[model samples]
Target: MQAQTNKTENNTNRATQINARDQRVVQTVGEAFVDDPRIVCRDVNVFYGEKHAIRDVSIDIARNQVIAMIGPSGCGKSTFLRCLNRMNDTIDGCKVTGTILLDGMDIHDKQLDVVPLRAQVGMVFQKPNPFPKSIYDNVAYGPKIHGLAPTRSDLERIVETS
Candidate 1:
């Protein structure tokens, strides 16, 4: 209980630091644009009612490249990543503005279906998210639903390879 209380206090301090940092109009480090970007975010902002969570953020993430989100405890790393897949939509009073594109398609488009978009672009958490049953089912679930494999043998092979 003491440790939990300490953690909460620490996070509160970090949140205050993050808020102060966001007030500075410093230029973002590194090049913000790229030619072959799989994901593009432009002037992205997030608000929880009146509180600005993320401010004027932009970046280009190229395909087949790995990137890390590193920051202080309350510095909006998860908030920005959530914008990539519209996970923020589930949160009440959370609103995201500006643009996010995946493979040149608008992620925030009202006409875009979220289910298949999520299937195409998904996040891997530190903990594995599995079905109730088996390892094979967990590995094969995506391919099975998307019809990536035409036959049972192919599915088995895909599972084995995974």
Candidate 2:
């Protein structure tokens, strides 16, 4: 009877341990995205050569929310925005470290292609920087590149409306 009692206690202890571990895993993931966030960054550091442009910045943007980051000029608002779409990749000496996650996926991972990433996250510049070409050319550029138009007439219609 004592042996049976010991076996039952062991099973109960094992079940308790498994439950604790499962709770911990769920808690850890929940902490990563607070308030139902869509984007989360932790310990995010960015540098330009030896100069640290952004340091240890952590922020979470919840779904269907608007966040405006306002500060003095050169406080890295545009720099951080550029980091989102990997626009800084084009710069000569810019470097970024740490991690940025979109839907809990690492965006800064080297394997991730920035092309489709930028396409998914659209960007409207500060001003309407029209293409050096005509209004028709400016509107047709994206449609043509993305193969949205089959013929020149289709491109012309898009240009007229856009």
The Cα local distance difference test for each model comes to: 0.68, 0.59
Candidate 2 residue lDDT tens string, 1-162: 000000112222111111121322111111223566777666566688888776554556677765565545556666676777776765668887767788777888878977788775555555455534566666776787678889988888888888
Give the poorly placed runs of model 2, Cα more than 4 Å off. Answer: 1-33, 123-162
- Runs in model 1 lying further than 4 Å from the true structure: 1-29, 125-162
Candidate 1 global Cα RMSD: 10.2
Candidate 1 lDDT for residue 85: 84
Score candidate 1 by lDDT: 0.68
Q: How well does each candidate superpose onto the true structure, as a TM-score?
A: 0.61, 0.56
Top candidate by TM-score: 1
Model 2 gets an lDDT of 0.59
